[model samples]
Target: MKRIYLLLTTFSLLLLQACNSFFDQMPDDQLTLDLVFQSKQYSEEFLAHAYSYVRDEADRKGGVPFDPLSDDFDVPYSESPAYPLNIGNWNAASGNYNFWQDYYRGIRQATYFILHIDENRELQGMAGGPQLIKQYKAEARFLRAFFYFNLLRQYGPVILIGDEIIESDLDGNDPKMNLPRTPYDACVDYIVSELDLAATDLPLHFTAQSERDYGRATKIACMAVKSRLLLYAASPQFNGNTEYVDVVNPDGTPLFNTQYNATKWERAAKAAKDLIDLDILGLYKVAGDDGNIDPYRSYRDIFLTPWNNEVLFARKSSDLGWPYEKHTAPRPIGGWPSYSITQQLVDAYETASGKRIDEPGTDYVENGFSQADGTYTEAGTYMMYVNREPRFYVTVLYNGSYYPSRVNGDQRMEFFRTGSSGRDGARDYPHTGYIVGKNISPNSDVRNSQFISRPYVLYRYAEVLLSYVEALNESSPGHPDIATYLNAIRERAGLPGVPQSLGQSEMRERIRHERRIELAIENLRWSDTRRWKIADQTDGGEFWGMNTGAGTSLHDPAYYQRTVFERRVFRKEYYLFPIPQSEMDRNSNLVQNPGW
Candidate 1:
């Protein structure tokens, strides 16, 4: 096994060299391939490292930032400074390159393993020998599928490179070296097949190796991914478009000869149903006295709990360890103060009855909540409404909600006095006002400075259930089963079930709305918007904040005037991120996506 690890490490080094010329001059002291594949342990470790590449921070940086580029919700001016360029404009030349490179890096490692693992006949002598090789291949395929899915989501029609491409082939000397974009359908087919291959070998759950392999890929994870990819492919954005009929094969013939088949929807439904039948995963239901349930509690807990059967796959990080939480948490009291949940996102939450605050008979002025809609009531004071939906309380932190430290359970309510002095004494403290809620751990013993590693869940059981319901609705429109699925989600969230009187369109709207609130800030919104073709909804806008300083003067305009253009609204061209110009320049065979 050690030999195999050395071989893989050596191969990875070679691949790294291939990535840039810097490593090319290094000595060939690295272990030979012959020495590495001799043992199963070594092979497994190599594959695990390859898996680690999928969730690496470098890969996450590009993808995670791109998430807000969708329509489900918007971030205020406060969060805009994080990535001013990408959020302010649809342009993502540098960001896309980063994403493309990281995905291909993982893909290359996977291809190397698939191409080599079978040749070693010595594997027959090891425990699980050929089966182990097959399993590893399956895992690699799964990772490949995941990367491809991400690429397709961002770039739309991308060049599909299944195997490692030799530099010589793309020396600008070979005609076949330059490949044009694959049709959207072709790319989807490739991803679907890869997931199918992966599902055949991965276990539904990890039972053999406990803690170490807990969050690794599994059969169910592969299925969840496939179901998600196919549903997106079949959506209006790609499948419903007739212009792409021969986009890849402009010669009056289909390049991949793929069609926008309705059967794809059925296939997605079946995949989702298969996962449900596995019975190992299901909705995290929280029942209410009046049968009004709130799914938010279950959803919130899913992120905090490790080895949760609900989480299919996740990127492990400590509690305060995740840089996102560390940076976003209130600084001085916490870490690098960054991304904050905006007032816009907070206001989107509905009351326990699933009604918006502005709805008729909602008692807006009496509740002290100002209606941003601008319709003034007789009451001079804006009511601060409370006790709406259970989820409203579970996920949001309003004016008076407790602001506990993510590390220690220390409450910031007292320390955040209105008259606190500024760090420089010349100006007042910026964050000495309100704090957000939900993501922070309420454990009082743990301080905000403590580093706690909590795994970042990529796919969880709640999503599995939601995906099943979504696929079922799309595949069988108006199917009676829609209510069953929709109600399950609502009931879990302490909300009333959808009335049977609602039409198909209304139900679909409700489902879309539910998904938006249910999955907000978990990093699914960006792709969700792309697949739904709603990028135009994210017009760049200012992030707002309240003025809380040393003075008690509420009339000062500067206190409420701080705003930043953190989000760029969506334009049609923003639907599919432009293919990096660098890649287009190097490969003549590459064609730019439409509207680039």
Candidate 2:
């Protein structure tokens, strides 16, 4: 399988490199079908390449502004004037197009392998042949499903190109190629069926010599992916859009598919439950003897440490590879200023006692600390308002908290007030009154920087648990399991469990708050907002910065005092990105999504 994969990969690369004018030219080194799948190892190698394609498209490193543009995160431009206010537009087209191409390329490769793999299986002599073939086919299906999920999220109701599509009379220059969109239901059905098939042959977990394949696709991963996709599909944006109803069948029958179905949500919950029943990968708890061990502390560490029992699937980073640390770390140390935690996000944390600081009579101050001596003053500090959510202090950096100083000889949390002069020779001094991160390391040694090779976490067990809870609550409101699941997350965060007496709406609010605080700045915020239909509430605004001085511009806001930018709203149309104009031109059958 490995040999087949390498040969196909080499062919793909050579084919991709040759210009359109050279399409007729065949590579002399190309392997014929007879030579390609002679062994199972060759087929396995091809599957590995399919997995690699998924990883390459998703992992946005090298300070490359790809991932953020996918609505997972945002790059606040506090400097560039050309694209100053609309930073979201950066990499919007370029990145989406690249992802589209990469995913389709992977799908095409998997289809090719599936088409030919069975023909060469006659060489297999005995015992393990059928099982191995089933497993390989399952892996290919999973890969295909994974690619389709990406397409569905980015471009709704995409043309479902399968091996059959390739063999159809509509292959080249056929007007049917310009056929209208496939029904979204059709797309979901295709995805769900693929996942179902993949799950049949995939192992629950690997052991012994197969331990090296721990991160590969598994039965649980397929189910988890299906659950997540279904949840999104049933959510407000896609499922709630009435205009998308009346989708046509091949026989031209109208399908009223726009209404949100409670059954779909129930199906999602059931899917998640199926994985939990498998009992292989469970939520990771903190280890050690500390009586007050907080499970939330393990959240950041999981990304830093891959193959963590909690990580279901992650994009593996090789030594000396790409990641986000270099861009977000303090410049003098390393890292560009990419994504920063907003004050709104900062205020969402709860007190250790489980009361939100903004609650009535809570004695919380916008700029005052609960403690005296003012060392960790809340005044003008966003971090101060929310004093002690375990997840809060664990994730955010504020005044007086020690950050590993790259510029100074010793680690220090420099508190720079407005008009404060630098005692030491620190450049970019006192820019922002508060440094807004605590998760990233600030080591000065370039070789040891955390930016490179930090594994990109695609899915974690914590998220899976939370998803199960959320779907269950949405489908069956006020279930006791709601509080149980909600409190499990809270307990990990060193807070008391949620009260069972709270109303369903109140409980929902609390769980959402927990999710916001727990998952902040982990690249999940934007999608969460979209799915919840709260993009306007979360993103529309005059996003503020600290007012440092008179010389400061919109690009460089004063980090010392409060400054606001007008109209930083995220419109509803932003929920789904517009399909690239180039793609639309090629496939006339594709319709531009509404408001694109």
Candidate 3:
């Protein structure tokens, strides 16, 4: 495990050198087989290359931001992938913003690394020779499995290329070169097995003494991935999905298993429990000097602080004025407004007392607007945004909200029309009339003297807890542990626990809403909806936004209503993203998903 300090600087140079191999018949700049095994530094460099694609969640620079595709947020700009996905303009070739080729290239590199690292003479007789080599091999395997998991989850059943790299001059006539799509369940099994191997060799945790080892594959990361992967395998969207009944291979065999497997729920529950029972991590609680826990600070800082105990896995971004801050921060304080929170997402958070607004016993009421076709009729004041969940205050920023701190002398976020920063204030404006508060760090604004970048949290303890509860409910309807885990999250968010009488069906809804609100803006909503096979119901609706267009001035109350933003179209066939035609064309054995 290499600390990610000045190495990322050299990694950029290595990437450039690797790119030089493309055109030159023989390029010294390339990461050749010889270059990797030269020393521990060089070997670790290659591992770092593989580590770059660990899917840390938010990468605006990567051209594929998944947050905008879901109903939680609306990306009004047409140039982004979000716009096309929202409008249903994407397809196998046309609307495709998928990561197939990049991830496959990573898989190839990882497989090649695993296959050759043992034979490196330099590594054989080094200071930490045997242990280092073993760790390297394990790291590479972890990466290989991780990349494969990413592919399988996105494209459903895909070919398991294994630890063999195709030579540049390989013969096309070889049957082994062109592999058929493996069964979806088989892919899951293979990935889980690889993770199991990885977990055995990896360390349980990284001490501050070895802080540079922070981002590398650890035992907990491997276990966490296994938990998530198994949960997906056990989900209704894949376990027994009738939607993919026709998703078959070129040889006419079903790709996805349509048979419901009850024991899979048990497997998922146990996997999540294994991670939790390790007891090394917890829902972050900010403690006062007097030892009182500040639930709000704890919940908010889980994202703000890097490598906090709550973070199961993360990628720390160099505070080099990263654009994630600039995008989510409003233009009133130098933000790009790339991701605007939706009205529906704002409504999803339970009241501070932990009751749904629509439920009978909640203090929060849905009162802003009334309409027939749309909700923005006779507009009311912004009072409805008040007294919601503690998480809500930390997640969504609206008309009268203030910044976490002063920036360039601005404190209150004046989002009303024609205010210092409003709809017409800058070129970058929130289309939904609400900014994403969750991703914006308190010190990330340009108004501050210095920037603070949080580790891009990929997996966390809260998600693990929710996964356990979900599996428990699916397997045992009224498991006693369900309320304990569910309320643990709620308690950390400054809310009460669940009601004792809550049934399985309502608890299922509770779990989904908890994920939506808890993992808000983490780019998990799209995947969650897909796995639950509820995209048609969850996504295919009229997207709503605060009606900031009804008046040119803040004096008019009509501008404060919930209005239709865009009518989304989610097809049942869209449950599985289409495998690119280019991939299918290249391999005769590769089968397209159920729908293109």
Top candidate by lDDT: 3
Task: Output the lDDT of residue 39, model 3.
Answer: 58
Score residue 348 of candidate 1 by CA lDDT.
62
Candidate 2 residue lDDT tens string, 282-362: 555675467665455565455555566676665544222223444334443443433344445555667666777778766
- TM-scores, all models, native as reference: 0.80, 0.80, 0.90
Q: Which lDDT tens digits does candidate 1 get at residues 447-517?
A: 24444456666776666566766777777777776777777767777677877667667777777777877
Which pairs clash (backbone N, Cα, C closer than 3 Å) in model 3?
3-212, 90-95, 91-95
Q: Which ranges of candidate 2 are over 4 A from the true structure?
A: 1-29, 56-73, 77-98, 121-123, 165-172, 206-209, 243-256, 287-290, 318-321, 368-386, 404-410, 413-454, 548-560
Reference-based lDDT, each prediction: 0.56, 0.57, 0.73
Instruction: Indicate whether candidate 2 or candidate 3 has the larger TM-score.
Output: 3
For candidate 3, what is the lDDT? 0.73
Model 3, TM vs. native: 0.90
Candidate 3, 126-240: lDDT as tens digits: 6888787888788888888988998987888888878666664556656666688999999999999999998788878654216656767788889989999999999999888
Clashes of each: 50, 22, 3
Instruction: Rank by TM-score, highest first.
Output: 3, 1, 2
